[model samples]
Target chain A: MATWLLLTLAAAAADFQDQDKQGHPTRAVLLGGSGEAHWNAGASVGSPWTTVTVQRGLRGGWTPLAEVQAASFARWQPAVGVGKRWIDRRWRLTGEGTVGWTLQGDPIPFRGPAAELRVKGGRAVGRFAPYLHLGMRSSRTEDRVETVSGDILREEARWETTLTGALGTGFLLTDRVGIDIGLDLPWVHMPNPSIPGMHIGVQTGWGRNQ
Target chain B: MHTHGVSMVRTILPFAFLIACGPPPKGVDYRGTRLAVVDMHLHPGDWQQVPESTQGYLASRFPFPFGLRPEQVAEGVLTGEAILDQLDDAAVSAAILFAVYAPRTVGVATNELVLRERRADTSRLWGLASLPVDRWDESSEAALAALSEALDNPGMVGIKLAHAHMHFRMDDPAYFSIYDMAVAHDAPVYLHTGTSPFPGTRTEPEYTDPAYLEAAIATHPRVQFILGHMGYDFIDQRPGDADTAIDLAVRYDNVWLEPSALGSRGSDPTGTNLPLVLKKAKTAGVEARLIYGSDGPQSPGFAADYLERTLTALEAADYSVEEAQLILADNASSLFGIPTFKAEK
Candidate 1:
């Protein structure tokens, strides 16, 4: 459903703020990396996570993206998808959908396919862009079902879901270089439920066309 | 050369991190005592019969490298022998095998399985029977009958309930009859309090808080209420309802505090919560009411690790050797009527 919605938005939305007069996108490739650390209130830091992303703007307000995300200091999940962003002057809105695999989820209790949907809205004030994001993530892991005699009759699939809401501000130090910091509220599904976390990142790319 | 050495150090660090799988934990001193070290919480399940989600949770927490999961180790292995070996590794005297019926959360470890495993070393192993409450509305009587019969076995020492995992309210009177059965059979009721990290467990204060059980605890004066986890919310690492549990223990003779699973890295990775709870229990002067349980045999070295963690916390909490003995062995021995050396004479 998220993918379909993203596709519909991409098709219906026009790049009024991002396209040149010839109807070509002005934005280019972006490479971003982020590190997340839990807010343990000074005693000890909880689960540490990192993510790296690549994005390229497409025509009609669409952007194609791929990312690798590792979490809890040991688990890794990589996803790829497309997004649509709308801009009216300094105001921005984005919707994206991604699918990935739990490449390695030790200490996270899952292994297999996963997906996410994110919607972010932000407004720029000079060099800083403040944003609010809401995201929904779902993943699948497998288990064996056995009869009373202990024979594996079949493999059952268990799906786990969690939500994330974040508020962050982006700093554009230079025309093509930027930094981002965010406070993240992630609902971790397996083992434990959730924890407070924050993220810091740097990205290099073309400035958003306006 | 320095750059090459730095790269080598980086390569070795991740490998070291991934090697959380092996180098089996060595047994430690049981506080330099030979008193009966009874671990009252052990979930021994047949690998084939236990749910895969449970296996996943165990494997995820105890990260076995090269895809050799800890949950797979017990396959075709002797369940009882494996449990006894775990006890030996942890330097514990005996451990109770609990039959869990949490079909919604961790899956079921049937009473039959618990009985079958206890036969491996009846002298050193015990069983705690639980009723299957999934269909309790239709089969409460039959389930009670099965529970009654299981309790009749000499090895079945108590009743086990995880209301959070079992999807029941504490004040719900439909299950009050279980306490009546416990009173009649002279069995203590060991119930899970506070929060569980497992998926599908109810985390509401209604289910996880022991305050909801206050009325029941008051009414069932003849029934001993051993609150498990000492109200430690494992998922959140908070001292959940420990004050209420301590108050109950102080207010009523039948109420007891169990500190099982409070020492696990999942629950208290910094080793702070357990000491805090132990200090409070000490302040309340209910050291004798504190029973030791590991919630153990979770993974390869989890039992040993949890035991070591608990001991470290006890030391940090300023518990003496004798108090440690009470928490570790003597108290449970007295509660369950397990014959110690003095009793055997």
Candidate 2:
């Protein structure tokens, strides 16, 4: 489902970019890595995750984006949102808000809706851009079969919130392609799998000149 | 573009610096506090040697409450070497092995097997001789002789009796000689004082009641008596048996409560009635008399789950690290006269 969502978004973004007479950036990015990559390899909790996102520049400083995250443990999430960017001299400021739904099917199948807000800032030094991002997400589940600490128990919908932050440097390989490396810190305190204290993620993106 | 870069940096750098300098991680470091773990109740015997009828009964009751499956019980039967490997994986310093003494319903695990295993690694394994009351002669000479022989073995630290399966009252005078022998040798006497899970077994709860041990405890005041299950009444969930067990421990300085069946309900750190037992023991001011016991290797996955759940439960209940340490190993070390890991260190 996440893959299909990504493909659909990519197609829509490509069509929008082609129809516009003015050259605008149309970007596709891929995110893939284990949450425990920075910690011991054996200490990984849950599963490795991959995400794909497509963003199309709109009028003014606004951009519309869509993303999908696919993971082992039968987890899938699809999100859509709009972002605004402000460029002042050598730095760029960005903010985005997304609403998504999560589906899981390990111990038992369950689905939940989630909302996230992210803010980021980056400064371009020649071909490299170093950036920092802070994000917060809140999720709530519908009534589903719940596995409470490994025991099968039926529970009503519940809400959970997580805070995430990242620091990274993006290298512009070409005018249309770039690579990013970052440390992702996701704070999840619930009694789930052992969440790694820190994780490293690498993402690649292709885009046209703005 | 230059202004854009400077403005963005100015807006985000301070926030980034603040977040990067934030406090480390919240929550306690559960693994940092090292505690020597000693499992005071482990049935490390070959289940293949179990009676055919008993095997059938266990097999039919697949998925026992304590996360034990009959197939896993058969598959998990470990040799002496395998037992050591399990202990290493669990970070357990030592374990007390019990030979099941239910001769009538289930075949007895010979004292010879337990002695041999303990002798193989005396530092890590301790043996408890199982005495069959039915095998005792009219004068109880056979029971006394067996207990004496077991105590003679350097690896045998105690004697275990199954009153439920053996159909003998715990306070029966016929077993007084065995208690006397334990006192003479300074060995603790372990009794199965709880409900057995075997459905078709000939066990009588009345025979195994914790209250019956009062007379025996009084009679053998010098001998240390360890209640194997703390008089757990699993079927009825009655608090009476457990209260009696705690009262006995509180009343007698020589009595201890070993919660072997505490982890029988899977890995819900707080599952089972163990926390209740701990709370009661704390209130009774006999918390030091509480000991840890897995009663395990019952299934392939049981031992680890048992140890993890037990520790997690203790930590979750806000048990002081010192109190948890005592229950984990110190109490057992003092009661059995075994050298604790701290002493060796």
Candidate 3:
């Protein structure tokens, strides 16, 4: 599934590159809902968690994003990503990739990184736009300590991948003000342990592009 | 500009309403049944009586960084009502208190102190007589006599031996009589089974090794034994000692492992070692033998943090609420026959 998603992303990137190269003079900031489902040893463990993301767009269609997420098990993850966007008279699209790190030291110490890919699309109305997003992510976690002689003393790691989708409306209140509300759903991809979860978020931002 | 501000408010108001009415955050609801906590290892020292040199020794051994004077260390010692206050604040229903009897390393907090405190509140404080068998005249009979008298205190739940600090092995003949008395009384025996990093104290790992207790555990199956620290060697990166402890717990049905100082041990605030130990227990199918202990209030403000960390780790590991309840209190409650509260409906 990860291989398929990676190939699909590559094809989408190629298609975007071949489109008519047109640049818009605009800068925008955005806030939205984010979330993920985590699995270990082929079992659904942690509860679903809501996450908040803040993003700022730069010139040349580049945007940088940051997010924070946590759950009741004292699980916490903070992430950062960058992406490219394309906008037209009645439609907007974006593709982003991010890296995240996990922290929770008991039952076991989890130390590792996760990489994600997100593609989003929106339809423009008078001043409000409703959007949908599809994303995929993979994570690698391990806890271990070793001796100076390069002996593996203790080690434990779990790898997982998830698919996510979201629905939301973006409101352009003025030339420089906007607000966004969204519901995020994430599905863990594993047999006999398909735990699903939902998260909602509201984000308000200011930028000339609105 | 005024119209633009009004438009912004109009747009933001609905978003705020949506947020206010939205479902609670994901994964925020813990399904595990909450159980009353019983702290199994607490050393409420008589800090004022400790000599300046010993205070200095303790300060040096402070798990986290220390910048306090010896007097400050002494002043910070939680005693009398202070111990109760901390327990209340941490929501711990009861604690098993131990006297410190390593006379050579640190002056004794005589068994009398533990008995006295336990007398103040038997329901909330259980006493464990600390035996400095090494300090007793080299006669097994003399040590057994001292232990027998301490056990005579109805409030004393068990005997605590600082084998590592006093430089003695568990299987040594000098302590066999004390073990016999503990078995006769049906009192559980608590042994310090890990290496300590204190600068002035004896730290021979062999003396505290869990493997050394094999013969004793086999000979005295009636006497339950709690291996404090699960034989962890905090100063080292390897898991050899901890594995040894886990192996012992797996091999001996009468043995249980308590991760007391792993979280409070200053060095690994993240307590990565705990998970490793828990993972091993699960693999060995010995989760029932794992108990919760906070070697604390000794390091003020540690009880709460340690409990939170242990619970979080347990939850993250996919341990069922029933399992969490067991580790949190049921195991210790059943082991020591202490009463615990049930989850409120």
Candidate 4:
């Protein structure tokens, strides 16, 4: 998904530069990494799972972006997302949506689509521009455990989801390439029925467009 | 050299300045203030040899309330390093390592090996010897010899007797010989008064009842009697409390209680009933008789974390901080006749 997103965004950037009659994009490729949903399926036979994503930015804001990404963590799923960047002098806004599938693991097969909206602003340095981001995420799971031994032994599969808000900062390596690291906590419900808990994720990613 | 000396002076100056700037403090004997406590009940498992299947079997047959799963037991067994680490972290002075085994022919060698290993680490490990009561007729000599040798090893503290194995009452005239040996050696006898995880025993030792211990205590008043599990039965229809047992300890100064199974076993196996035991101890005025113990590896409730929580619970049970210190350290020292009872700094 990340690869495809990057390629599409790069193509869009080239077209926008040509249309501007500048021949050169004032914006470089935005290289950034992200953590996306591997699977969010709840405790049932078939629930959608989410993956964590990290990415790199290739250039400045204003060019559209798209990518296809395979997770190094969750073995059975892959994803693709596309979005456009609207850049103001010092501020950048990005919107993207992703779709993917997770293979069945002993108990559950997951399938789902997710959407992300992000806004970031920061001071730009020579090759190091640090920016903060805010975004929202949601996912579901389907899986459960039952007592095969007797009726009295009660075991249930759990399903959970969350609404999340994040505060993070990343540095751009150059006009087209840089790394972003951020921490996000889900305030919504967690699927594991044992305890009401929260998850914190740190994501990093990079990209390039000509 | 001059520049290096100046750099050293610069680094040292702040520390000296801080000390000089502080008010003069009261001189205190901090070394002897805190007691060094070592729990005697620990089961370190041999994960390499015990199969997961075996562990599963152990768990299913003896569930958490009865027994911990093999992995839990295995973890408890290998937990020596972790326990030592916690002890180091918690400032525990030493630990008396012991094991739990059923009364079977194979159990003899296993128990002996455990004792030998525990004895090897005399500096920190006080190996408690286990005896197979059923095999006493055949293995008594071997058991006696092994225990004598281990006790003679300078680190081996005392003898650990589990009632589940013997099935004979504490008052049984037969155990007198064993008591005689322990008394002769000036070694303490730690007895388990609890229900066995497995059935099938020779006599179903009724003497485990705290009431029965009176006769033995009366007769062997000089022999140190360490009542393991705090004289309470894990599955007793009529469990004895600290009040009944404290009478024994108060009557005979030789009598003591090692709270090994305090957090595990009993009807409320999760240790929900522990406060009751601690209460009875405090009420009975036997708080100092309680020692830090955990029937480990076999009992799921006896972990390092459990030990900490147990102490916290005891402290909360209105036990005086000093009494809690004694129960956690001084009591075990007095019972085992350890001279240097203070926590090592």
Candidate 5:
């Protein structure tokens, strides 16, 4: 995901020809929500246990664009793929779609290639912005349950998906530096191993155009 | 002339735009202002249980009640649901969880299980793995290998050792193996010094003396040592016998004191007696050397409440608020390498 994010950013930079009237690409640092990925808990009876998606936007726009990401948790393995973004800057609206394969890590019920969508935006206060996001995500999960007689009776695996939402605020310190605090509803489903539910994290990047 | 003017205008344009943009509004320090319950000593309770499935197949199992099964014999053991309920009811945001079994005796199986559980529950659980200090014959090699294995695990944030269980003094060359291991891991060691309960426990009131640790610290300059039980003698001994322990922790730059059994179980071991230790830590000007710890199952319900009460009692006994915060959170965070308590904007 990082490699692809960087590549896309490089492509964006190559696109910026430094035209005389281009206004220097509006280089403002972004410390806002990355709604490109929506985390979901196992709500469906036959879905993966947990799913996590981390992605970045190489450029800003209101139309769908290409992206890369890795999704995993439980039996699910980390997968990399191409994605698209949809944005409506006026009301701070944004959405994303991605497809990738399970690259590495533990693999079980999970299969290759996953997809996601997110909508977000609120009020932008100069260098800081607060946003709300809602999204749906899908993946696969697997487990090993032993028998009473000490035998491996069965391996349970399934492709699952969930709906998630979060509220967050971020600071755009410079064209390349930013920070964000988000509260995500880890699992929207029941009967799943409760892990990595609600998380608070900070991310910093350099050479980010969005 | 026109091109020169344009270049100058471009330089000023970005500056003018930045000035017009102004600065971002400052957010409140939510964590600092909030009343957080800091339980210093806690363990991932379920991991203590011997997995029934793992045991059922065996012809004979270790006599120890392993697994989540609760027996009336011990007040500290709790079921999985009950353990979660305690935190849910307490509004606790942080806890320092440590393993109780001597790593050398209990082996890595139990410690490994505990670490896995703590990693899965990071927000409320900070796990300190037990170091294998029971085997003193080859103390250095055993300590190094055992601690290295436990510390290599990312889930393991710190090292835990009990002088009583290991039968080694903090100063003994035999135990320096553990110190060397902890230094290599870049994590803190929660040394079980001061006092213990079991009869014939190696750390007697005299040998458990905190001074023993000074030379070790001098030799192992990089190790960060946390004195457990507030330096209180474990078995019945003279009152305030841990004075030397307190003095050493206060005097040493690397030594730390955790309010574990001291505030709840010690020479006068009771919830009420906790304040005295806090007072001593303050009077000694080593308040900042103290950190939070529960020594659970060893004590009762006071772990969650002691942190706040200890601070209040210290102040009532003439300690400063600054001293209280240092003991409750700041020092522990610094000593244990807990990034959560670091200052940030």
Candidate 6:
């Protein structure tokens, strides 16, 4: 399926102009959903995690994003981030960072403050772009979720981390609209880690913002 | 662009349908040995009652993920109908549903809900009563009264306790009276006997060690104690108390070793430890004392996957067919008196 999609995308790219090199940077707002299967993690520990994201593309290749992730809708983690992108004929690359909060759920012992850093790269043809993303995410969990809202008397904590990656293609419907779809690959807390997942996103923007 | 967008939807729709409509779960094929399955450990909860942490965990347990919010999906699956549908999908003959009251951790799935669900009429669902132990000193009497009442009902087979999640110590003599209640009711006790990853659970040996309950096991010999998770420490990711649990089961006849959650990817990615534990039980000639519990329904098809995982582990341990039957179905049936299943001739 992936091979067929990539071949089609390559064929489409051949007919389109390199607007990435000639036109202005994209400034768009995006909304999307993501899902990952953690059955491989541990039946008790891994929940089919689904996440929703909202993003704002800023001027001069800067972007800000926010998201809420749910582990089977049982737990929720919300995060905010910013990234910078560099585009050319062959690749559209981005580097981003974010901090996430485990607001409620079992926390079993405590909640979490998680941090992530990611990089994405892709190429565009006409309105289609296929990208690959790679990064790292880390979090601390224990009894009390450290938050801005409350006081903590004592904290017992541990660290968890994962290597994050994704492969997807984006389609620009018009000068102001587009969609992105991909598979997310994360190696969580390795020796053993999590498996690949899926995400879909939609966006609208002012094109060629010179 | 509109055409392209339409095309994109058309392309993705098939994938969505595929996820929504998964292949019917073809449950564990017992080869030639006809073995019925009774899943001893499962937690059920309401969407509103579940803590966000638990809600997150519940979201992905099912096989499908589309057309609804994650919580909405969980809310749907938590229902009696959905539970039964899931059970059918996994080919589970019957299941034991636990009533959870750990508000600080997983949240509540009340005893009343367990009894109220219509699934009880189908005989596919059974109950394990859980009491509110967070306020032990203040409400122990009322809690026991409620528990006793719950146990009096049909299909209420056991008492489920989590020393770690309920913020209690196993050896706290003050709480040991609960065992006396177990003795009177003829209900077996299922205790969470190892470190849990859930926040707020007590991880110390006092709370999690299977050895901590030896005295209680001895004192209440009439009351059976089924050690849950087989002292598998999920947080530390080691076989935390498997040896102690196996030792206790070997030493004490009233104790039953339950190796639940040992087959999970998070606990044992290589599928290594459970087979060893099974081998140890067979070696010790304690297979009859072993009861099978998947600790599942975690993700949609997990109950079936866990059963298959466990049965595979049984094969890995080289457990003979008779030992497998004892561990898989016979032991649970002997204790609960649930009706039996004979494989089709």
Give the best candidate by TM-score: 6
Error of 3 at A63 (Å): 52
Q: Assess chain B of each prediction and give its TM-score.
A: 0.86, 0.82, 0.83, 0.72, 0.71, 0.87
Give the better candidate number (2 or 4) by lDDT.
Answer: 2
What are the runs in model 2 whose C-alpha is more than 4 Å off?
A1-210, B1-32, B60-76, B135-139, B200-205, B237-240, B266-272, B343-345
lDDT per residue for candidate 3 within B211-256, as digits (tens), equals 8888888888988988888887756633447788888888889988
- Candidate 3 chain B weakest lDDT stretch, 10 residues: B62-71
Model 2 chain B lDDT-worst window of ten: B60-69
lDDT of 5 by residue, B222-320 (tens): 788777776665455332445666787766778777766565423343455567766776788777777766665322344444444555555566755
lDDT of each: 0.72, 0.64, 0.64, 0.50, 0.50, 0.70
**lDDT tens digits, residues B1-345, model 6?**
999999999999999998888634423456566676677777666768867665544443322322124556566566667667666676666678888888977788899887765364547688899899867889999999999999998868889998888888898898988899998889999999889876556788999999999989989989999999889988867787888998998899899999999877667878888888888877887878888887766556667778778888988888778777777777887887677754332
The runs of at least 3 residues in candidate 1 whose Cα sits more than 4 Å from the true structure, single-residue gaps closed, are A1-210, B1-36, B48-54, B66-71, B74-78, B341-345
- Scoring only the A-chain of each prediction against the true A-chain gives TM-scores of 0.70, 0.64, 0.61, 0.41, 0.48, 0.64
Question: How well is each residue in B80-139 modelled by candidate 2, as lDDT tens digits?
Answer: 666666665566778888876675565677788887767658888988886767756673
lDDT score for residue A91 of model 5: 34
* Per-residue accuracy of model 5 over A1-210 as CA lDDT, tens digit each: 999998876655444322220111111111122322221111111111233333433334322233322222223334433333333343344454445443323211234455665555554544445667677767655545676588987877656565656666654443333445555543422223222323333333322222
Steric clashes per prediction: 0, 14, 4, 93, 20, 38
Who is ahead in DockQ, 3 or 4? 4
Tell me, per candidate, how large a share of the native contacts it keeps. Answer: 0.08, 0.00, 0.00, 0.00, 0.00, 0.03
Each candidate's interface RMSD (Å, one decimal) is 7.4, 13.5, 18.1, 12.7, 13.5, 8.2
DockQ agreement of candidate 1 with the native complex: 0.07
What is candidate 2's lDDT per residue for A1-210, written digit by digit as tens? Answer: 999998876665444334221121111221111111111011112223455666655556566667775444245668888666644334566778889987754222347898888876765554445777688877787654445377646668777676755666655444344556555555432333223332233333333333
TM-score of each candidate?
0.59, 0.54, 0.54, 0.53, 0.47, 0.68
Residue-level lDDT tens digits of model 4 in A1-210: 999998876765454334221111112212222212111111101111123342323234322334332221222434455444544333444544444443322112333444444444443333233444444544444433334474444434433233433343434322333343443333332331111122222222222222
Cα displacement (Å) at residue A91, model 2: 51
